[model samples]
Target chain A: MKIRPLDDRVLVQPLEEIESKTSSGIIIPDTAKEKPRIGVVIAVGTDEDLREKVKEGDKILFAKYGGEEVEIDGKEYRIISRSDILAVIED
Target chain B: MKIRPLDDRVLVQPLEEIESKTSSGIIIPDTAKEKPRIGVVIAVGTDEDLREKVKEGDKILFAKYGGEEVEIDGKEYRIISRSDILAVIED
Candidate 1:
């Protein structure tokens, strides 16, 4: 099952968080939590200017809480509007 | 502390979820969790077209997961690209 966004929205597959911790080395138990921050651009919207700005296969840093969640092929993806994108990752 | 997003991004303040559950009536433990879904548009972006599309004080539904997190006025807000907005709430 393929998912596509309408207008300037995009479909993103979020990256899984590492089981290990970063700075404090505090293992984040399921209790203490925040939103997910990293993701991959799966599908681009139909806006031309936006299309020029971003493309598919771009690994982007999106807002941890930006798009709507939809299940496709048992995988979770976000259907977000164009305005919510922050920056496109270059690495 | 005021935070404004750059470019086509908007500063969004996410709404808090209710303590109760939705359909299943199952209390979502602090462990089994997901990201936030609703937010209010705070600051509009710099892009002229995007600004025209969305505005300040708009209650919007964004992707369940989208932008970067910032602390402002001791509150957490998401700075997301305009593309992450799904629909603008009129009510």
Candidate 2:
């Protein structure tokens, strides 16, 4: 199904986090196991200011556990609100 | 020092939480020990829209762990941003 974010919300595709491990390759267990905070913007919200600040295909840093998770056609996505977005990642 | 919240931030004086004990006198420990989410608005931000929605002396419900704490004249207060404010409480 197709989805379009409304208002100041944005649709994002989360990137796989770099593995939590030491240089020696020992995996360190993260007790919290929080959701990854890096993603690429799939779509910017309808708000004018939001559209100006962010655009589709931009990499972004979002708050930990910032958005609601959804699964569509065996793929995962997140719908993030404006406050949850921390910064636009350049390059 | 006097504080005036700039932008969309609000200065608030938090109300003590009613306690985590049950009516039968069982005390439940909060593992996270998060901050309270309610307060009385001491001052509203300079944003015109914020000012129209909130005012001094209004009791409000804010987000959990939403603001920064500050002590002034031996009294405690919090600086809350607009996104952290959930709603105004009416008596």
> Which regions of candidate 2 fall more than 4 Å away from where they truly are?
A1-91, B19-36
Q: Candidate 1, residue A56: CA error in Å?
A: 0.7
Model 2: pairs clashing at backbone N, Cα or C within 3 Å: none
Kindly report the fnat of each predicted structure, to 2 decimals: 0.04, 0.00
Model 2 residue A89 lDDT?
67
Query: Candidate 2, residues A1-91: lDDT per residue as tens digits?
Result: 2344545778788775652222223222466476336777877755689999999988777876775554434455666789999878665
Candidate number with greatest lDDT: 2
lDDT of 1 by residue, B32-68 (tens): 3553356778887657898998988887767656666
CAPRI category for model 2: incorrect
**lDDT score, candidate 1:** 0.64
Question: Rounded to one decimal, what is candidate 2's iRMSD?
Answer: 15.3
Q: Candidate 2's residue-wise lDDT over B1-91, tens digit each?
A: 5688999999998776542121112121233233225568998889887787778987665555777989988888999898766445444
Looking at model 1, give its docking quality level.
incorrect
